[model samples]
Target: MIYKVIQINFFMKGIDRGLNNSVVVLLIIQI
Candidate 1:
């Protein structure tokens, strides 16, 4: 159970990073 939770946490972090990257890209485009 603990391992599964850790795996999910890492997965979520990756998704968050992707979202942040997209936001950055959008800002660059708007500039």
Candidate 2:
């Protein structure tokens, strides 16, 4: 159970990073 939770957290972090990267790209394009 603990391992599953850790895996989910890691997956979430990856998704967050992807979102942040896209946002940064959009901002750069706007500028």
Candidate 3:
């Protein structure tokens, strides 16, 4: 169970980084 929680947290952080990257790309395109 502890390992599962750690995996989930890692996955979520990966998603957050992806979202942030996409947002930056969009801002660059808009500008």
Candidate 4:
């Protein structure tokens, strides 16, 4: 559970950097 939160945070960082929004959405969906 902790790892999942961390992973989400990591992806959030990517979003903040203006990374691919769709890819992030897909990843979050998978999670």
Alpha-carbon RMSD to native, per candidate: 10.9, 10.9, 10.8, 1.5
lDDT of 2 by residue, 1-31 (tens): 8876776676567677776777556544644
| Regions of model 1 farther than 4 Å from truth | 19-31
The list of candidate 4 runs beyond 4 A from truth reads: none
Against the reference, the lDDT scores of all candidates come to 0.63, 0.64, 0.64, 0.86
Candidate 3 lDDT, tens digit per residue, 1-31? 8876776676567677776777556544644
Model 4: which ten-residue window has the lowest total lDDT? 19-28
Better of 1 and 4 by lDDT: 4
Q: After superposing candidate 2 on the true structure, give the runs of residues whose Cα lies further than 4 Å from its correct spot.
A: 19-31
User: Per-residue lDDT of 1-31 in model 1, one digit per residue for the tens?
Assistant: 8876776676567677775777556544644
- In model 2, state the lDDT of residue 11: 58
